[model samples]
Target chain A: MENRNGCKLVDLPESTRRKDRFSFTLLVVIIVLIPVLVESKYYLIVLNIIGLNTIVVVGLNLLIGFAGQISLGHAAFFGLGSYFSGILTANYGFPHWPAMVVAMLATGAIAYLIGYPALKLRGHYLVMATLGFGIIINILMGELEQFTGGHDGLIGIPPLSVGGLTFDNDLKNFYLIWAFVFFCMLVARNLLDSRVGRALRAIHGSEVAANSLGVNTSSYKVKVFVLSAMFASVSGSLYAHYITFISPSTYDFYYSIQVVTMVIVGGMGSLWGSLFGAAILSFISEALHVAKQYHIIAYGVFLSLILIFLPEGVLVGIQHFYQSKKLQRLIAVKTPFLLWFNRF
Target chain B: MSNSDSILELVNVSINFGGLQAINRLSFQVESGQIFALIGPNGAGKTTAINMITGIYPPAEGEIYFEGQVLSGKKPYQVTRMGIARTFQNIQVFQNMTVRENVMVGLHTRSRSEFVRCLLHTPMVRKEERMIRRRCNEILEFMGLASKAGLLAAGLPYGDQKKVEIARTLATEPRLLLLDEPAAGLNLQETHEMSHTILMIRETGVTVLLVAHNMDLVMGISDTITVLNYGEKIADGSPAEIQNSDKVVAAYLGREPW
Candidate 1:
């Protein structure tokens, strides 16, 4: 059968086509109903957290998944954003909105500066440079006590207000966070579908080929690096405003690893995969309250299980399974028909 | 041809890889709407010359002019924007992407829009996007790949991958197209088809520059043939002159002919 676009799915065996259609429908339904099902204030809080995490994961996805660049220091950008916004709002008396904007810009600028030298390094060297950047930020967060509020972390931050309305409660914050998350997802999707996204993917597949294709590979790399940094900064701004507090400990290397895990566990190079990954992992971390004592151990076990059984990640595995089932169904339906038709 | 008719002119181009000279003062002109062949034995710097012409490597000496515009210092993408597109000796399709998506990438240079237009799905952007897709489909159909548009490039057979690469280069709407070893892995029948395709591409007013080792295929379709050996040009003339050149035979055989 052909889809409305005149793209033929009949060429794909019946079982395979059926599964594809079913899974696509299922995905759409889930996306449409997620907000409606999240009714509880507590669950809404969880969703807001998911939204914040999704932003960082999407950024990390562009860097690691699309650009084929590994960054273990993204938390540096996150922490920098938080500190930048916290300082501006707390000391400069800037509004939270402008502070957030300034914070994102600051993070992007810093990323662009560091990317010039950091992007020159490849593979393990790149990892080292990023790790060094993270360590430096973490150290600065503590040492710059006069500006950053020291180890006690900045507190008593104001809520985000717009047009005489303040998002002071969990419900309001949930909508705000989710709106930002949706906007971010839209941006990420657009970037993935645009020329820049294609160039990034081409570089990921093979940088040499990408260069030959007339892509300025080095410049594109730096651009994605800065763009992803800005994305992480936005998430950081949301976190600071929502909690009304900030700490260096929160935006550590461990947090960066968590974000990377979310992207990888979702399915590298798949935007929807990153969302699924963020939701599943974040849910697991939150749901197992008793396992909080061994949260690290629990996280390790969960990640290990995902890596072993679903090496391509949960979303990719699900997609593969759906496709195979669809193919089986298509063959089952069409084999006899083909034989009868052949007799004619 | 006059200077205006010649889309790409490489004047005394030479590229040195460290101590080794890959292309030694090589010069040629690709007039618009002609198929020009560059043939050489293994390690004769055929790909190296194509690389320089396509902006992957800067010539150690010489100037490249495309449509009266100097292209020596320009980047590869800048060259592409100037309407020169090329394929690799090894098949270089974006393996993870579908064939249609791969072709769509070639259309990227031609697209005119900011990031905001794509994000908002503005009517104009959508219209332009649809037009590009339609054109991509047309190119695929011309290359006999309409049915496999949705297939991941890596899944396609070698011959089809080669065709997809050519189709992608065509999507750029280039004035000059360069093919590096297009018939490298093809069977005799496929090579015949490739020759026909090359002719078809030439008929479309796109200059063709083919680098190949297959003499029979090269002799069959090339309007002008240039032979290279040890980074130096050995022969430059019509296909019949190339076939009869003693220097060409000596270069291919590694010895002077009787």
Candidate 2:
């Protein structure tokens, strides 16, 4: 993909000389090994939860990582998808596929409602508005005893199946879920490499500069916000169908915090990093089950340390570290090509 | 080019922020393909005028026309789409982005790839991106930044950072480019080099309307000059005529150039 003058994907520094499909290659290898790697259903199911979170993180990465906007109520959108799909299929006798689609559209409308005008103005209003939305949704879920099954939650949601193949078991659900995860990874990767994603990254740098360069900053922001919510909604639908049970607690402020933590820990603005963030956080929280009393403190300490040392997130920090070392070694070896710039 | 062929016009434009008039009844004409310079001291509303022209803020009292279309009340990106591009005074390069990526941002309006095509990574999108990168490299080469195109813009030296800003704006392929203090922090040698680049840019048939405090650079390259004092145009004329204007000398130059 490198041009004759030695430029590749403009934003990618590592694979500039190469085609830069490293993420895709990594994705293919991971998808092929999950069944072989995990023996127990508990681990497989835990991995599935991580897959669902990964989807949310992928969308959030575009909004928060690339566009530099934060949302504190992603879990509310997740809840919308879960409840909308669950109620339609389980209670209303709708087909699973159509229910999912309807749920997605409904969630999209809600996202538009929140993102359009709420995202119009810049700064902390978005944070406050999303926070307010999360709390309000949480309250509504508790109060709508007839629709949501109230605090007790809902059950009997149908499992997803296509062409008579059902994902009723953990192994079946594993492939079903990871397929979406990697598909999302592919889409997210393609997007970041494109002009639309570049515009988002530009806004992240400085919106004033991006605007002068002909970027509609507010439009991009709203679109990313909508896209992020849609991803969360999809994950929610998947969650409801897989478990056939969901409560308001599943989409509370605490869960929203968990999603944001995943983005920050894995690395913002990276698809692979989102997967890592979700997987690592899920594994840590599950592994600390025996140390239940100290789990929250340990998790906080872990995330804080990562943020302290690698403020850009894990993946970017690693890349930066690796590149700096290579640069130091090259500088030590010879003054090299960049030294020629001194003449200017 | 015809002497009276104006590419951009600010017609009695005025704007205020909380009762402080940033620009007041400012009017000027930039003839097509000409190198026009706006010169004044700090707080004389030069940057505010640039902001108004670029659609950062709508003129509260009048209109701005680019190519005979009213530019007032349009979005910033819309104005940019109409062939106007600009650089910020305080070097606003996407610091974390490499020089190539920064220019790619400037090439955004020029890209015609659809969202689905980009999401699928289709050949058309790939081909379009390659074209943009090629054009970006040429701009970098023109700015003498080709050697450092792979480096992060924030990591570059101050003088080189300024060049990168201009390079990014050039990538937009603007019919009319506004440069705000392109040589503000440069040394004498860098200023000379920047003035050379500005002249070369003008030679490419892209009109340049610049705001700079460096009187020497302004007087040397500007085809026409407009002096602003306290949000008002004090004088507008050819560079030779401006260099001799008593009001310009008394207000802006404050001394004889010779």
Q: Highest DockQ: which candidate?
A: 2
Q: Which run of 10 residues does model 1 chain A get worst, by summed lDDT?
A: A8-17
Clashing residue pairs found in predicted model 1: A1-A10, A14-A330, A15-A326, A15-A327, A15-A329, A15-A330, A16-A326, A16-A327, A214-B77
Every candidate's TM-score, chain A alone: 0.85, 0.89
Q: Please provide TM-scores, in order, for all candidate models, with all chains considered together.
A: 0.89, 0.92
Task: List model 1 lDDT by residue over B1-258, tens digit each.
Answer: 228778888888999988999999888887778899999899999999888988889899999888888989888888888888899998888897778778877787767755456656577766767777778777877787877977888999999999989998898898899999999989999999999999999988888999998887899999899898988888899999998988888788867444
How big is the positional error of residue A106 in model 2, measured in Å on the Cα after superposition? 1.8
Docking class of 1: acceptable
**Candidate 1's error at B57, in angstroms?**
1.5
DockQ-based CAPRI category assigned to the predicted complex of candidate 2? acceptable
Q: For residue A119, what is the lDDT in candidate 1?
A: 81
Q: Compared with the true structure, what per-residue lDDT tens digits does model 1 show for residues A41-91? A: 788778878888998998889988899898888898888878888889987
Q: DockQ score for model 2, please?
A: 0.46
